[model samples]
Target: MNNQSKQPISPTAHGHRLVVETLNTHPNALRRLHSPGSAENELSELIVHTALHLDTVQKELVDRCTWAAQDLTRVATGTAAPNSLGVLQNSGLQIDLLAARRADAKAHLRSALAAYQRVTTIAKPQHAGPHPPLPSRTSPRTR
Candidate 1:
């Protein structure tokens, strides 16, 4: 008889794992998305958009962490008194979790920005100089 019971997975935990995995794999995945044609440009554009979106998400995570920390501070200082020890402890635990999440989000955001920069560099023209004039197609006799 199997005595081990399966533990339920939280949706938030699963989503976080997915996000981490995606970020870890993104560079290779982005490379794979590039091809010999217009797809490279499209992929670079997509990466830029994704990086911008991640920046927004990171900002929100920072805000959440700040709020949670401030709330925890208030509770600790008795500025916002809790009804019981249990409430205070729970609030502290929640704040700790928020801080952890904020750290993870920041790391992910940095990775995304790096990827965006790499892709944009790849998309840029190889020659930095001004465009050369077109060679004259007409011969002396034709001119």
Candidate 2:
């Protein structure tokens, strides 16, 4: 007979895993979206728009993570009888990496925003709404 505990996954944990996976896969696709002239065409423009939307969402999540870490640091150090701040101190490496990733996410979002704006400017559609344009040959322009 099996004796292992059949533990259920917490929704928070599941969501975290999903976010991590999405973040992992998005960078490559985002790079492709950023290729020159990608916004000139409709399909590439759509990909860029979708990638931009996804990037914005990812940045928001990364911001939340930074906030949570800040709160954790406070709880670990600000209390009268503070909890083990050692954990945070010991994991300094990971914390630093996370901070770097947060910054990287911000930079990526800025790039995506620029791409979306460029797509809108160059691929102007007849009707008003957010849609990607066709990929066309152009310079890598940014604000």
Candidate 3:
């Protein structure tokens, strides 16, 4: 059997298992039997995976930031009223948590970008004639 017929990549981790399962289905369709561009297709799949992962991370970060902003707004609007000190303190703590989450998200994004760069650099498509272009990872590109 062709290596292209091999099983798809799947992560064993609980949440990732479902994602893995979804991605694994319909491999034959992804291979494009007529085209037979195995290497290029594989690279495209990787890029797609990276993009999705980054999107999820960014969404979570945005959600955290929004929640923090809402809490702050409530504190600002309500603190002038009676018995608001405890609520204000809780809101401050939540804002701090959101700030930390934002920082974490930024770090994760940087790491994801670095991983993408590494994949592009190390897996050269320079010689892939008649196939899709694989971004080079040999050197960092000027943004």
TM-score leader: 1
Better of 1 and 3 by TM-score: 1
Residue-level lDDT of model 3, residues 28-136, one tens digit each, is 3433522345554654454345445544554554666676577777657985343445765675676576557545644554454455346546766566558777888
Cα error, residue 28 of model 2, in Å, equals: 18
Residue by residue across 3-90, what tens digits does model 2's lDDT show?
1112332333322222234333322243453446554344444444444444545555565667657767777787534446665464
Candidate 2 vs candidate 3: the lDDT winner is: 3
Candidate 2 stretches greater than 4 Å from native: 1-86, 125-143
Clashes in predicted model 3: 3
Q: How badly does each model clash, as a count of residue pairs?
A: 0, 8, 3
* lDDT of every model, 2 decimals: 0.52, 0.48, 0.49
| TM-score, cand. 1 | 0.40
Write the residue-wise lDDT of candidate 1 on 63-93 in tens digits: 6667767877897898987556576466567
Model 2 error, position 38 (Å)? 7.3
lDDT for 6 (candidate 3): 55
How far is 98's C-alpha from truth in model 2 (Å)?
0.6
Alpha-carbon TM-score of each model against the true structure: 0.40, 0.33, 0.37
User: How much RMSD separates candidate 2 from the native structure?
Assistant: 15.9
